[model samples]
Target: MLNLLGLDAVAESVYRGILDRPQDVDDLCDRLKLTEKEIRDALDRLSEMALVRPSTEDPGQLHAVSPHVGMEILLARQQAELASQKQRLEASRAAAAQLILEYDDRRADAGSAEAGVRYLEGIDSIRDHLAVLREQVVRELLTFAPGGPQTQANMSASRPLNQQLLERGVQMRTVYLDSIRSCTDTMKYVHWLTEHGCQVRTVPSLPNRMIIYDRKAAIIAAHTENTAAGAMQLTSQGAVTTLHALFESVWQSAEPVVRQARPTPGALNRQQAEALRLLAQGLTDEAIANRLGVSPRTARRIASGLMDVLDADSRFQAGVHAVQRGYLPSTPL
Candidate 1:
């Protein structure tokens, strides 16, 4: 291989001999025991590598280039190539670093003992991590959600994961605020969950949202003045266990949802029910519609209907009437 690259042992020996003194072809041939043709061939190869040059003193003789000079030229070419490669590598590394930083910002609270935190950057990443935890939740799954009903978007994201957990015989328990009982989408979800052998309960008020999986992992939203866009995952077993303990304490104080009393007929339509539920939770009509998978116009119409039924002039009054008339379940108030 070295010979294929314009170099060989014979060429090196010929170059070394020439370095001692300019040698005519006959002198080189006699000293190396090489035929004149062989000495000429070796010198030709060395000349091609720029390691030997024809002697100015004699047209038939050759002189070896100083090894230092030859090596300097080769090293400069190598250095230039390496510099180019380094520039490309640095550009690639910079782009990768920016991506990691952006992802870390989104998942800053999912602390890890590893060198880098395992970030759940997008909704897909969150789903994937949830799937892994669901698989590990052999014993139980617990949740406390105080916000409006799980949006259709959230339900769509979680359904497949919940099904997988159910298939693995994992036990599930969910506690929701009483407002969920009035949400058509939530009712649908709750019905599905019950059918899958999961237990569910309702409390009059919920302080925050939480999910604990197998006493191993917990997800909590940061306590910010602006609660949205501030969430974190906790993977410490001890901390997760404490959250689970809190969930159980709340669970014991909640009321079991009576499946028989679930509205079947003469209940509000899905959109209207979702609107009323969100309104009761103090969500604006726009946010309610966004969560309910409906248009804002439809949400406004629902709110209007609720007001008419409650014989109230404003949303606040309507909410008060609904609560008083048992439109919402009264549980552990």
Candidate 2:
């Protein structure tokens, strides 16, 4: 009960023990079954609080003061300290809000600050700022995550944030490599996202990794050799329009991951048809792997398998035969 007034367990126990009877340090150690250091530390804190005192007959013996007097004084001091901290915290909060408002006002007035482009360096910074952007999204969030499915840890990090965004009633549409549906970790995330009102689609290849928040601000990753180099944030009308148009084109041809992508004839399997289309586009094996969400070796094996199925000796021959088989249209699109 004394803990509510700032007394810790050891201090409270020692005070109660002294109230039972005045005792020397050695007696306290024996009765409380505590180390001498612990008993002495408790006595020192209680003495400072005026909750304990030395016996007049033997200065080494400890005695408890009246709780009605001593504990009430301790409680009053603690309450005053808490009130002071609360006032300081409120002042800091007000100062921060005012500072941010003035900074934004000044930024809006600066001509150079109107460039509408922000270059962010480092993957961690990019992710950190993305969280900031997510909070500002109101109407919709459109994202294209190219290359492959995200790792489990990364997905876990954003899982709650994504769910919270949906709960805010923000419309979300995401695009990924068609192969994400086969990965256990990413597929699980995708399932959860869709269940919570996120619309998801997939394609054999996406032009780049991009996110457009309400079509107002667009962020594009600049990655090389599967490593994130940095990112670009574009807010100009021209840039946003161009990126949105590109997304629309891809979104049109992309397959819906679930609740969509029904079969169409002319007739290789969906995986083989996607592989053939990518090959016909002259994409390298590694690029194909990124598009297919598979390893480079697996991508090469897929290409080889397609070649055999078409009875072709080379990729060009495979493309030609695949077209004749109606797996791909004459125009690559």
* Candidate achieving the largest lDDT: 2
What TM-score does each of the candidates earn?
0.43, 0.61
lDDT of each residue in 114-226, candidate 2, tens digit only: 86766666788888889899989999999888767788788988899998899999999998887786687898898789889999887665556789999898887655344
lDDT tens per residue, model 1, 102-164:
333544443454423344444455556666676677888888766656789878877887888
Please give the CA lDDT of all the candidate structures. 0.62, 0.72
Candidate 2 lDDT: 0.72
RMSD of each: 31.0, 26.3
* Regions of model 1 farther than 4 Å from truth: 1-124, 223-230, 259-333
Error of 1 at 58 (Å): 99
Look at candidate 1 and tell me the lDDT of residue 225. 22
